[model samples]
Target: MDVEILSRIQFAFTIAFHYIYPPLSIGLGVGLVIMEGMFLKTKEPVYEKMTRFFVKIFALIFGIGVATGIVMEFEFGTNWAVYSRYVGDVFGSALAAEGIFAFALESGFLGILLFGWNKVSPKVHFLSTIMVTLGSMFSAIWIVVANSWQQTPAGYKIVGEGMEARAEITDFWAMVFNPSSVERIMHVWIGAFLAGAFLIMSIAAWYLYKNKYQDFSKKAFGIGLVIALIAAYAQLVTGHSSAEVVEQYQPAKLAAMEGHWDSSGAADMYLFGYIDKKKEETVGLKIPGGLSFLTHQDFNAPVTGLKAFKPEDRPGSLNITFQSYHIMIAIGMLLISLTSYAAWLWRRNKLFEKKWLMLVFVWAVFLPQIANQAGWFAAETGRQPWVVYNLLRTSDALSQSVQKEQVMFSLILFSLVYLVLFMLFIYLLNKKITHGPWHTDSDKHSSRHSDMATELSKPSSQS
Candidate 1:
């Protein structure tokens, strides 16, 4: 109804859709390195085939991630012109660093990694894979640094310009390692890794269930399960640390997430409940003293509540924040359990033969994606009224000149385009998986090429 509300909706929709691809790209990049590295080590044709098959998939995702991401960058300037101008100096430097250190390096090596199978030596090709993977991670680093600067307002000074104030970068290193950067980056990368690992396991589990490519599926599942388990466990630690940072720096947001209304010592953690903000109490189960221990590592420590601050200063929809956080945590725990069970089965040499379990794994591939989206919702929605924490209100950040109808039209267009792109991606990926690699006869051709070239150059074998 309102222009500001419409603008917020448009941005959120675009960002959420765009987010789906990048984590897959980053996670798949790491998986590609692992697959290719194993091929080099074992000199196995199956491993090489696996690498080639998935690299094609990775290339498609990388392209989509880049394509979708470009639109959001443009929106920053077009829809949120004032916000862009205010944070431009800080954002510009970080973005420039991303282009120079990440995008360029990754793009340069990508062609070689994709097309140099027979043209380059194995060692050289492996080097290219490493570069691409690191480049993806480097890209994430700079982007997170820029976002974290907004969250914590570090490495910058506000300069008064006319009536409004603009931020200027004052300490470059401080900006890179802002208060929230380390925890956020760690949480994000681990989520990416989990997304990639689960994807591989899902496909492999399907193949195993159908009794196709049994050996390949077995190896793929084993490797994927191990990586998934480790990443999920590491995420729990990082998530806790990130929550601690939020408690200290963004108490209102944290208070909203836990549905805390009255400040108290030895707070209770609501395990499953609906909080009636009007009544100021939870409607279901809660674990007393859990919140205090979680936040401060002590049972009787004091934790802030929403009542501590003015009502208007609070972030959006406490119910949404609480539900999203709990759902994400539940999914994370489920991932750990599933992978752990898979690992135990692997140790007993029974994982590949479990038909029901394999089927579950096939469908359960979507769980990590759901968890990833929910986690993002909890973080962004939890931040509420402030676009840059207490420094800038979201209402003041929107472009004054843009019409509501314009935002609505663009939102409709974006949704249709993204839906088509998603369908195409799924179709192409399924085609690649079904058809297998281009060179299934890789072993036969391995020595044939070298021998044929050598003989052809040796005076026509005059004997």
Candidate 2:
């Protein structure tokens, strides 16, 4: 492979791994605010204990997210110098705003949120929690805005010649609110919320299954379920909205996503399929004209297909884009079903009674994470060939001086380092889960004693 391929793979690997945490951090940040707010409103000790326990977990996620995230910025300059220079002026403004509006507020309040428990008044601590949540969300806004601007260039003009060429912001706010930004931002925010909510529910489900901290787990699961329910439905709506935006601005990507090749007819929405690129045919289940109705509210509306673009201009690999997109959609539908069923059970006061359901919740923790990653894979891969829509071809954006060997070596090192980090994360997370929320020795002792009694009452054959 050449430097461009190696660099792309290296960046993709780092970004994908790094992505795991931010959504969790963003999602968990929202959970923290709600948990803390409940404590404030009800003056309940259990709520405070829950808030404190999760705050520790949130800190762990935030620390790793920040650490892993710094590498991407350096990659931009080292691996894709041309790309960096091209978008630097635009990215600079957005990132600067993130530093000022998002990072500053989140970090300043973070200390209070983590360690200000008894030292600060309850109201003050609650305010800090809210600020931290807002900060994380605000952080997402600028990042998505910058990325979306690449998908749909706006309020910018090319201002140099040859290798010195770059885009300069002609209108700052217009650049910030680029055509695709608002929709993408909302889509990203909801995905993060779902990630965080599911993590909480997964942990809570495990606790409930083990018959540990019943009251606390119940409360936590209830809150997580509520958020998951709302976010799941909201994602469906935003997913549609985002798709519409893609249809209008990046139809080739949309075509690649659905594996549609012909421009003479309406597009079919595949439930699942395999694309045979050699034959240029997709075989599997599909709804006739489903995409057309979704995009144009008419079953026979013509949606642009891959045939509309030159072969070189289309997404480089359509199968990857198609599969990634379908995976995301499948997970989204699954989540909606899961949340709706869980809600029904909760309403019937039978949620905790179902071992099967709680078990599903425990494993379902990974679904949102998968969905988030898949969504990004689809978006980025679908935009292939063009790192900045019509403005900059990805091939033209590489750092000419970089070598394949250097990228390969760095990729190996990054893999090893990230493996260690991942192991550490799992170890810490497991340690915390196993420890449970034992505020006092008595609480721990009583919970253990209760577990022993419950076990003793079970059938000996099972034991």
Candidate 3:
């Protein structure tokens, strides 16, 4: 009912929607690099075809991400003017750098990547792919530095006072390497890679299931599966390291994540089930003394609880954080299992024979998207009340002049528009996929990807 609430909802919905595409873009960028790199190294025509197919998908995703992301910038001036003004000095620089150091370079090479495949040399094309991948990562780095600074404010001093106060960066490098930046960015980038890898594997699995593009499917699927397994393991390690950092910097968030409410001694960590927020207790499965062992490797270590903080200082939505954290964990574990099993099947050279796993892989494309969303939900919701952690409460972050009706109207309008956009994306994607990766052998046509090849020898189609 409140204007601030409406504004928050609007920003959250639009940003979340915009977020969906970027990870796919980032992930797909990694996929593109691998595909094109192999094309250069091995002179495989299949790899070239795969690179072209992914280029189309990547371009589409990049277009949508750029379009949707512009809306968030407008919202900063409209819905969060006060918050923007407060941290403008610190945050604006990061965004500015993102544009200059990241977006410009990526966009400049994107033309070469998408269209220059036919016009340029293969080695040159491969170089473009690498640039795009690095650009995506650089974009993520600056944004992560900004957001991580909010979670763990450092390298800044408060200027002025009260309503007129603003944070000014005192040490630039210190701000860049703030306590949570590296860990948070590592987790985010890996998640993006997972999103991309699973998507490729999912599409490849579908082709195999339909008995279409067998050789193409096998190669693409194998590459994606290998990357998925490695990224899955990397995610586990980064998630653990991030948690350790959170233990030191954002203990209240860790408290909410594990659903631990005791003020002292060994704390139980809930693995699943419901949190009784009213009672500050968990109502499901938990590992006894898990919290203590997890954080300190000691069963008797004291973990801070919500009760330790004044009621007003506690995160507003403990239940959301608790549920989101567990949901993320559940999906992450499932992904590890699925990728591991796929690796086993491939090792035996019987992966396609398992129709059950083929079906699972086809549907598994949605898993990384879900897991990525859940992880973010846990992180953002758990850091609530304070938009800038301990320094700035979210209540103080809203635009003073914004009205509830204005935000609500925009929210409704944006939601409807986004829904249509989503339907269109799926429709076009299905159309492209249903047409198959490229022409079959019966067509007697030179492959569409032939232009992308610069090798001394032509690749013979296998199977």
Candidate 4:
């Protein structure tokens, strides 16, 4: 394989693996704040227990997210040195802001959040949770801002120095509010919320199934179900808006996403399809005028197609984009249905007792993760060929000095290490779920020591 292909694969693998954690962390961080805030408000011990139990999981995810994210930074310099230099002026400031305003602030208070539960007052602890949540959100903001600029290429002046083209920031605020940033950030944050919400719902459902900590599990389910439903719904709207923006600014990508070969006034949205790239057509079920209405709010508005662009300017593999976009939308719709059903069950007071439904929830735990991954693939792969759209091709950005053998070796090493880490994460997470939070119940203690120590056992237990 070519070194560039190997390098791209390595980076994609590492990024996709690493991405699994951050959104969860970000989403769970907000859930933590809500849980803790309720504990402070209601003076409920069960809520406090829920907060303590999940805080440990949140910290574990945060640690891994930080660790894995560092590799991407190094890869930018090592595998794509020329690309890094090209966008350094724009990306550097965004990254610097992330460090100064997001990572540092989040890290500073994270220790206090983890260990200061008993050491600090409830008000102070709640404040810490809020700060951590805000910090995580801010971190995402800068990242989206940087990536959005790459997608839209705004607030920058292109400087041609000999053989290289570099971007210099002309307006910092404009860079922060790039055309794609707001919609992208909203979609990202909502996806995070869905990830965190479904995780909580799955775990809570498991606890209810086991008939353990009934009150705590019920409250957790209620919170998770409600938030998950809202976020899933909001995602539909935000995703639609984002698509409209893509259609307007990145017509080639939109064309690939819909597998549109020729321009039409009323485009059809494919529900499912197999694209024949050679034939430049898709064979599938489609909704007529759906694409036109989605992109332009008018069925008769002309939609651009891949054929309108020069072959060199086309974004990426049409089949990949088409499939990824459809899969993402399908999963998103499934989530909406599932979460809405969960909410209805909760409202009827029949949620906890439904064994069959609980089983479905257990299997559906990975839905948000799948949707998140598919959405990312649609966004990134849909905007391919050019790393910075028309401004820079990926091939031109790769490091000229790096050999194929070196990248291949690193790729294999990364895959092995990440696989081990993923297995370890699953093992630890399951162990935590099975063990559950620490309980102070006397019955549990007495059951443990009944045979050996009669004096240490108690007859009555506190609830």
The sequence of per-residue lDDT tens digits that candidate 4 reaches over residues 68-123 is: 89999999999998899899999999999999999988998898888876567777
Q: Whole-model lDDT for model 2 versus the true structure?
A: 0.91
Off by over 4 Å in 1: 161-163, 437-463
**Which structure among the candidates has the greatest TM-score?**
3
Q: List per-prediction Cα lDDT, in the order shown.
A: 0.83, 0.91, 0.86, 0.84
Candidate 4: 10-residue stretch with minimal lDDT: 447-456
Worst 10 residues of 3 by lDDT: 440-449
- Best of the two (2, 4) by lDDT: 2
| RMSD score of candidate 1 (Å) | 4.3
For residue 208, give model 3's deviation from the true position in Å.
0.5
Ranking by TM-score: 3, 2, 1, 4
Q: Candidate 3, residues 1-463: lDDT per residue as tens digits?
A: 7987788779878988988988998998998888878877777677888888878888888888888989998998898877888899989889999999999999999899877855677788889999998898899999989999999999999998888888999999888999999999999999999999998999999999988999999999988998899999899999999999998999899988888888777988888877776887878898888889988898788899877887777777888888888888888899999999889988998888998888899999988888888888888888888889888888898888888888888999999999998888888788878877684331332433464343335444331
**TM, every model:** 0.94, 0.95, 0.96, 0.94
Error of 2 at 250 (Å): 0.3
Clashing pairs in 1: none
Q: CA lDDT of 249 in candidate 4?
A: 85
